[model samples]
Target: MSDAYNSSWFAEKLTDRSIRGIALETSALIRAGALPVGAKLPPIRDLAFSLGVSPATISEAWSELRRQKIITGRGRNGTWVSGDSFVAKPERLASVGHYGAGVLDLTMAVPDRALLPALGNALVHAVSTEKLNSYERSRILPELEADVRRTWPYEAEAFLATNGGYNAVYTLIHALVPPGAAVAIEEPTGMRLLDILEDHGARIVPVVCDSDGPLPASLRQAMLSKPVAFIFQPRLHSVTGQTVATRRMAELAEELRDTDVLIIEDDGLADISDAPRQSLGRVFPDRVIHILSYSKTLGPDLRLAVLSSTRLIIEQIQSYRSFSSGWTSRILQGAAAWLLRDETTAEGLKEARRLYQARRDNLVRALAERDVIVPSGGGLCAWVPVASEPFALVTLAARGIAVHPGKKFAVQPTHHLRVATSNLTDRYEEVANAIALAASGG
Candidate 1:
């Protein structure tokens, strides 16, 4: 845009910043009128050279600005500030378009039902010829708990079975996280997780991540606010399918080394994930809470997951649950355990994992062919970086494609939107073309 940088305050604020910090300060400059809305930012190389920082830093700063709606990319026309402090973008659900038959929805993360085996068979096998009367039994049945525990990377003194992972999250947030406290979460997290956290009266502090998962610097920055817990999806991370590298997980564990911060690993996709499940729980077993949900793997109707945690948290959950729904039904527990050992179900799950991986991988390749930022793999969804969230949302929606706006999941400003790839098994090119157009300032 401009070779002659007008803002003297810009370079001054560039000191002591991770790329994200630099972006935040540039936003401050725009809000203060140093770089007024509609004014073009200085050329990336020029600003980076002027500030003695990398051009990548300037690029990331510009990206983060666009994400916040503080700036807009006008293709070859160049980038310009687009909004002011008082004119922040609204967070409203856009009305869905009715494209009827050809419409493809990439919003929800659910699997293709046709790929899974018959849950009726599993349930029938579980309930058939069994004594159905149980007046007194542990909230978590002993046999089911033991079976689920065998899959965990680490051992727990006691296990708690919840209706599902989200239920377990609610239990944890209510019982563990003190009200009015703040918790750390991955930026661009699930919208429902945000709701649960807010419902339980917890403030959110986001940690920015790359494909390998949350950056160590971002984690360090997030912890600076002293959040009460770190709730992150370690594997098959929804919307991105980003499984944290073992080395990166080790780094994260080291960061929480001496802290009291509770770490919750949301292993949502469970056995459906192509990657071998890895957890930071092994690093700090006493301080970690691991939840593995099977709804995506078996059948959503099962509503079951294994919650592995320390005795203290387990007891707290039980005590809190005593006055509520009591416990997960023993029948559902039996069904889940029975399904886990079912040969046909196991083969179907294996195939489902392959199909999800293929779709996700193909979508990533398709998007990348068009030069869209495709940070994905090992999950049912993909995260595509865009210059503007609203522009992408509207542009894609108008093309008979539906997807969640990236801003809906952002705790801080970010420039990416999630696309559920599983349903696009046969429409990769079509969806990718639409995304490329939208991301190109449609």
Candidate 2:
């Protein structure tokens, strides 16, 4: 409630009244020490009147600052400058993978390196690609597109290759969604997805999910906010490992029948999952954007993922890409194409699928023996419920085993642990015993 830094001062200093401009200028003032920490901001209506702008504009600017942790408080409580730092990071992704030595890290849900197919022959085959190192902005290599089309869930109007799965998602959201636009996503989704949405200043409306998939009623309720897009993992959810059932997909399609919200299906597991891929693209081809990533099945170093959608949407995403990394590497695309068609690669993937399934089943069986039952869904991790997230994390850390807390992947209250099983090949019984004790809060 300082009179020195009041509405009149902000109005005089803020030449640009747009949302971004207001947030940026206010942040600068805070960093310059003009607006010291604990300085209360003028109410939205008063600031709008002083600047000759709408109250909503000022409100949005404040929201952006809040997301960055620069300011705190809202409504009748009054807003105050909390911090000077403006850089917002991926909180969940940054917090994991920092354990000390001698700790079994089960936090990263990545594929086992030993199981990945050899890339020597594919690299040699890529040397013969049709267009080698041209500066042209090709959406995708012809050979790669043709190979992917064979197993695509449905006929898409166009396709674009990206650097990776998360890159494809980040680009699409930045290109299509404006700041503060509502986005509907599954509740217990990948932590990185949440980070991307928050970085874009999106208003996330979480759709709750059951074992089958995102519940129709929850999706129907989220639609009330008119989200611009709905993003969900179509096969083998990275955290939960559950596949959306075919019946659930039909019901979801029915729920979205009348709306124009873009359906973004992220098939990150690719062919690694034994379950067949499913998508809403079949029902609404014009409105669905499906992305298939090869990082899990193929090597992560390749960094290739393909997205298919209507020509207009694809073109928009491509246009955005022109600003940075105009196109994915043709050599990598060629290599992926060769591997997809290679019989040896196919056999390796089949064997990898079998091995991953066995590893996951082993953990599930071990946990069950300790009276802790969890679904053996298809993915690299297993979601085991716990009595308390804090207690479970502390107990597991004491045992030199590190696992991700369930709250990291949830927008709502949840008590569980996402334990990686892809590399849990040898210590199944020992790890399961630790998990069992953690679940019982011992």
Please report the candidate that would top TM-score against the real structure.
Answer: 2
Q: Candidates' lDDT values, in order?
A: 0.78, 0.92
Once fitted onto the true fold, the runs of candidate 1 whose alpha carbons sit more than 4 angstroms away are 1-102, 128-137
**TM-score for each candidate, following the candidate numbering:** 0.75, 0.96
Q: Among all windows of ten consecutive residues in candidate 1, which has the lowest summed lDDT? A: 88-97
Q: Per-residue alpha-carbon lDDT of model 1 for 1-442, expressed as tens digits?
A: 3444444445765674567787777777777876677787766676777777788877866766665677888446777878876343223322323456866878877878898678686677567424444644355766677677777777666688899988889887888888658899987687778877765557789888877888889999889889999989888787567788888898898788978899999988888776777777777878788889988987788888888878887888878877777678777888888877778888898889888889888988988899986755667787788888899989987898888777777767767777887766697898899999988865
Q: Give lDDT tens digits, candidate 2, residues 1-442.
A: 4777789999889988899899999999999998999999998999999999999999989998998999999989899999988666798898877878899999888989999989999999998888798899999999999999999999999999999999999999999998779999998999999999988989889999999999999999999999999999888898888999999999999999999999999999999888887789999999999999999998999999999999999999999999999999999999999999999989999999998888889999999999999986878999999999999999999999999999989788998999988988889988998999999976
Residue 186 error for model 2, in Å?
A: 1.7
